[model samples]
Target: MDYERQPYRRCGRSGLLLPAVSLGLWHNFGEGKPVDSQRAILHKAFELGITHFDIADRYGPPIGAAESAFGRIFPRSLRDEVVITTKGSNPMWDGPYGKGNSRKHLLATLDRSLTRLGLDYVDIFYLHREDAGTPLEEQVATLDHMVRTGRALYAGVSNFSPEHTAEAARLLRDLGTPLLVHQPPYSLLDRRIEGSLLGVLEQEGVGCVVYSPLAQGLLTDRYLGGIPAGSRAAEGRFLTPDRVTPEVLAFVRSLAELASARGQTVAQLALAWALRDPRITSVLVGASSPEQLEANVGAVDGLEFTDEELAAIDRAAKEAGVEA
Candidate 1:
């Protein structure tokens, strides 16, 4: 696919090079969408220079469906051409060993994920979330084991706080396995990471693959006029109608206007803003259609920002309560 045509960034100190924009299967690519439709998105993303596809056990509605569906369309020719990341630590089944960061659950889920992915090993495997009930040492050891045993080439952590991330990095370093990446939600509407997480990752030399860079589509023009029919908000799942409040919509509209001035869509602007951080390895995005994916890929075309534009974005984001 000549994916190298696009510049890839090193994941922290690791040798892994991920595209600036990665596709995420956190939404869509599941049972609700037709198999062919999902396949088209994957094809289009690959053609656009995206090499990373993020997946998790609990992504699809029925859970595990996203990985299974993606596995079905995953071409053997492209397997080595791309980087596939799957996660555990979220509940996909009932019972004591069904979820959490316990070695038992993490390893079992990795095996199941490998079977569903139709691959012996993933490019990266993540501990989907922190388990308050589990000890940090145990979780880090489990991830280290995954890499040692060749079930995953690298290890990552997601939805972890800055403090936890720092500790995890320390543990992984001692085990001779540095934390490869951390997946967190970061957008104009969500800047919690900037307060501390970003610095931690940079200091620890851990790359970041941020998800929800579009704030669940609130940063896009799609919700400018209000939630459209069949949209995630209208469906009242991850993004409910109530979440698209007057304040948030107002913020989205303002961002859209600024994007128009830059001759870019709101989605593109948000994505480019995310990549502005040198510590960010990639901005993980999810698409409902091929067109959406194409537009997102365009984000890379114009990522430059003048000081004035950066200030304006900061002002708008603060006004929108992103900093609050």
Candidate 2:
């Protein structure tokens, strides 16, 4: 709960300085989770100076539930103290303009998001994904309009490839509302961003807020032994028990050993590894409990890595065939 414990990093060339580690409502804080649990995690996050909270229109089990829950737990007076980012462009309902990067869909979703979040303007509004059917120009223009109309303070894109991100960055820059951040998946078990996306973001001066930094809990001590009861691998659709094969367990054990030598957990080591890249503005992590959130935020303390440790990490990750 110490404010000075979390450090802030500049978002690209923008004036915004976001916390080194951000929280995402991608999992938990939804329909299935209790309201009291969601409130506790969110309250603890803010108390720890984790000012950025990420969410999407389609994040909840039943779409729009996450933002609605946040609206209930987050007081209007303290809204200015935190950075709220809600994404659209993902299908949330049945309609012609329910999904896509089209101007109509984007604007309609923004209005719905605002109403659900109980806010006049969000800190950042992102187009959740790339739509091959829609032109990039239409998408950027719509996001530009959101900022111009005071519906969103900044615009961003998520799950876009390096090529798409480059094009979108150019378009948004031309529109005078430069792309603020790109939310991508980058973790010890997934280093695809290092191949080219990281370079692209750096060249364009667009900050990156990486998601799944713990590889959906793969790069954690939780799976070192096996999938425990109620773990994401056992219950979540994204990560399944079958995905955690013997080979993965071996790699996880090695990584956990390395983390132990450093007096940290695998989750902390994974987060620290992701932060090693300067291009990464923040690592967006999700938590089901307040204790988990606190442990993750403590990762900032052991962020320093020796050259030998970095090399060992790369070797282990490469052996797992997870490198980009």
Candidate 3:
């Protein structure tokens, strides 16, 4: 439980400091997984100084399972020591009020999220995704309300385009909420954020906590040889076997070689690459086991990259059809 083993970074212009690597309870903290195993991963991650834990209303396989499981294992005594964040705006229930950025939907979902997490207030609550059907003013207002009412300390958004992000930040600022962070998918295979989202975050002084830094396990060694049984791809959950094409395998092999030369694993190399940008407040990683979490956190040890290595990484990504 050496807190000093991990490095902490300022979350944009906020007073909060997040670990370079955070744990995401998207996959492993769901039903069918043993409670003890989930607890072990959470404990191990905290011990490694990963204070931020990201969850969503629709994270579990059936939905709401991750939060329920987390509530069972996370001790109330450590609530103040960690940063707990959850998201909404995705489909979670039936009928019209099930999803979206509407005030009713957002507020109602947060209540349910709090009930499930067994927390009086979350450190940060994010709009899981932009609901174009709802006006930006309404969406931002709901987030502001969450913070002002003590339901959440900070507000954030995820999967928002650069234009949308700018507008949302403006609206939140106008309401005196001040957007805290933005969660987006970022990795070697997906560099869409580099085009403008990162710039907007930097300009707006909003923290960037990126998820899927491993490309849903694509950047890891799990698919180096082939998709192993019980893997995400094999299970057809988020990642499919078709995505492990020969070209992708080749790209990953190149990365593996580069990682080996640097005395690190491919997964670590990818995590480090994502965190290479100073705008990135933290990289959210998912783990099925405590050992896996430890390996991902190792990425922080090699966050720096040489000029040549960066060029080589771009070359490999472009060759694999990535628009980097």
Per-model C-alpha RMSD: 1.3, 1.2, 1.0
Worst 10 residues of 3 by lDDT: 315-324
Residue 277 deviation, candidate 1, in Å? 1.1
CA lDDT of each prediction against the hidden true structure: 0.89, 0.89, 0.91
In model 3, residue pairs whose N, Cα or C atoms come closer than 3 Å (at least 3 residues apart or on different chains), thus clashing, are: none
Tens-place lDDT per residue, model 3, 148-211, is: 9999999999999999999999999999999999999999888889999999999999999999
Off by over 4 Å in 3: none
- Model 1 clash count equals 0
Pairs of colliding residues, candidate 2: none
A best-first ranking of the candidates according to their lDDT comes to 3, 1, 2
Indicate the residue-level lDDT of 8 in model 1.
90
lDDT of 1: 0.89
lDDT of 1 by residue, 1-324 (tens): 547545699999888899999999988877878888899999898888989999998878689899999989999888888999999998878899999999999999999999998999999999988999999999999999999999999999999999999999999999998899999988887888999999999899999999999888888888878889988899886898888888887777777888899999998998998898788899998988999898998898888888998898878767877554
- For model 3, what is the error of residue 182's alpha carbon versus the real structure, in angstroms, after optimal superposition? 0.6
lDDT of 2 by residue, 1-324 (tens): 456988889999899999988999999977989999999998889788998999998878789999999999996778778899999888877878778889988888889988998999999999898999998899999999999999999999999999999999999999999999999888877778888999999999999999999878888878877888888888866898887877677778888899999989989988988898788899999999999999999889888999999999879767876554
Off by over 4 Å in 2: 320-322
Q: Model 2 residue 313 lDDT?
A: 81
Q: Could you tell me which residue pairs clash in candidate 1?
A: none
Lowest-lDDT window of 10 residues in candidate 2? 315-324
